[model samples]
Target chain A: AQSVTQPDIHITVSEGASLELRCNYSYGATPYLFWYVQSPGQGLQLLLKYFSGDTLVQGIKGFEAEFKRSQSSFNLRKPSVHWSDAAEYFCAVHLTGATNKLIFGTGTLLAVQP
Target chain B: DVKVTQSSRYLVKRTGEKVFLECVQDMDHENMFWYRQDPGLGLRLIYFSYDVKMKEKGDIPEGYSVSREKKERFSLILESASTNQTSMYLCASSQDSSYNSPLHFGNGTRLTVT
Candidate 1:
């Protein structure tokens, strides 16, 4: 079975500091990876996605993720964390078969500290 | 911009009561999905519909049913509302089953079954 794992349950980072959220996935074929962020009482928004071309993909709100096939990892990173960046981050893998199903990880909650 | 609208922002129900959660997408998307978001579970898919009057079970479909009578409307039904069914339900839509089309989610409905 395909699965996604986000090791960190909660992380606290000082405002303006660099942030990195780890994500790992288990799948047989070339995985279609995606990162999504959910704010308080709001729906999830797509941060970035990794298809085929580039190893490093840029996304909305000054976020980027690098897909490392060997590591089975797609880690999300931001140069400087803002107070508004505090949210729950989820990593998902698209299952390419008869359906468009996605396997999601246990999200990591980020708390931005001033 | 695609807009996925959930009919309710919050709901409370009694056990064994039948419950209905509504979702509507303005983009006329072909794929609509229902997922439950928990504290550490991230999001677990409950049901999905690829087209009108078509529905499929997802990872966690127990105690849940779906109806997609129209292109823009998808409804999730809880046959017997239980305390364990209290969760944040999210509705999402995508253009197709392609890798390029990402899901657009609604501001979830927080359902609490007493």
Candidate 2:
């Protein structure tokens, strides 16, 4: 079965501190990994995506994620945390084929402490 | 930028009532999806359409149906709304279901069943 896992249900980081959110996936083929952020009462926004090419992919709002095939992990990281960065982060894998679907993790809620 | 627009922000419907959620995408995307998002359950796929008039069931398709008569419009219908069906419904579109395509989501509809 194909699935995505976000180990951390919630994380708290101080302002200006670095942040890392773990994401792992179980897939059969080459996975297209993605990180998305959802603010309170707002829709989801793409943070970053890794299709192919370089393992490190950059996304909007000063976010970056590294895709590791060996470990089946695509971890999202940021150098500094901001108050505005607090939101629900989701890790997703795009399943290839005619039905192209996204398998999502339970999600990690990030709280930035000022 | 790709724009996926959902018709409602907040909706309140009574139990056993039929509900319709409309979505439109300005980007001529070939793939459109409907998902229900909850607090701990993350996002569950309800239905997806790869092309005009083509529909496929997703992870959770029970009590839900979809319509894609045109290339840019997709609608999700709930045969009979239930309290458990109250959730944040999101609509998304992608250029294709391929690895290169990342989904663009709408503002989401928060539906409440009474």
Candidate 3:
């Protein structure tokens, strides 16, 4: 079984400041990691995904995440966050070659201050 | 861009009522899924369909059922609407299986059971 854990329940950052959200996972084999963002009263949108090859993956909205195998972590980061970037971010893990079910973390709510 | 459409943005139902939530995907995706989002719980999968008429139980499938008569359409059914089922229901679809492909989600339906 695969599971995900997000230590931070909520985080507040100033607009144009650097942002980082931590995520950790526990899976048996190589994992497919993904970051998704959901705005208020909206569905989730894919931010980025990591399968193999590059450890550092760039996503839309100037968001990026790095997959650390040793740390079992895939953390999302943004150099400069905008006010519109305030949303709930989720970290999920999928087992390669298994059922397409994704185990998601508790999520981290980001609040941007102007 | 992939477009996943959900039938309703909000719904209110009484306890013991039969509730139906419909979802459709324009990308002809083979996989469709239903998930509920709560405050602490990010997204809990209720049911998933890999193909037409092929439904699989997800982590929380106790009071929920699903139907997939066509490749691009999936429906989630609440046999008996309860207050606990009141949450944001998200519908998602992927080209192949969700495990390997990034999922596209609908705006979501907020169901309020009283």
A1-114 per-residue lDDT for model 1 (tens digits): 889999999999999999999999999999999999999889999999999988999999999999999999999999999999999999999998746788999999999999
- Candidate number with the higher TM-score (2 or 3): 3
A1-114 in candidate 3: lDDT tens per residue? 578999999999999999999999999898899999999988899999999899999999999999999999999999999999999999999867655788889999999999
Residues B10-64 of candidate 1: C-alpha lDDT, one tens digit per residue: 9999999999999999998999999999998989999999999999999899999
Report residue A70 deviation for candidate 2 (angstroms): 2.9
Error of 3 at B65 (Å): 0.8
Query: How does candidate 1 fare on TM-score?
Result: 0.99
- For model 1, name the residue pairs that clash: none
Clashes of each: 0, 0, 0
* Model 1 chain A: worst 10 consecutive residues (lDDT sum): A95-104
For candidate 2, lDDT tens digit of each residue in B17-39? Answer: 99999999998999999999998
**Fnat: each model in turn:** 0.79, 0.68, 0.72
B86: Cα error in model 2, Å = 1.0
TM-score between predicted and true chain B, model 3:
0.97
**For candidate 2, lDDT tens digit of each residue in A1-114?**
999999999999999999999999999988888899999878889898888899999888889999989999999999998999999999999888746688999999999998
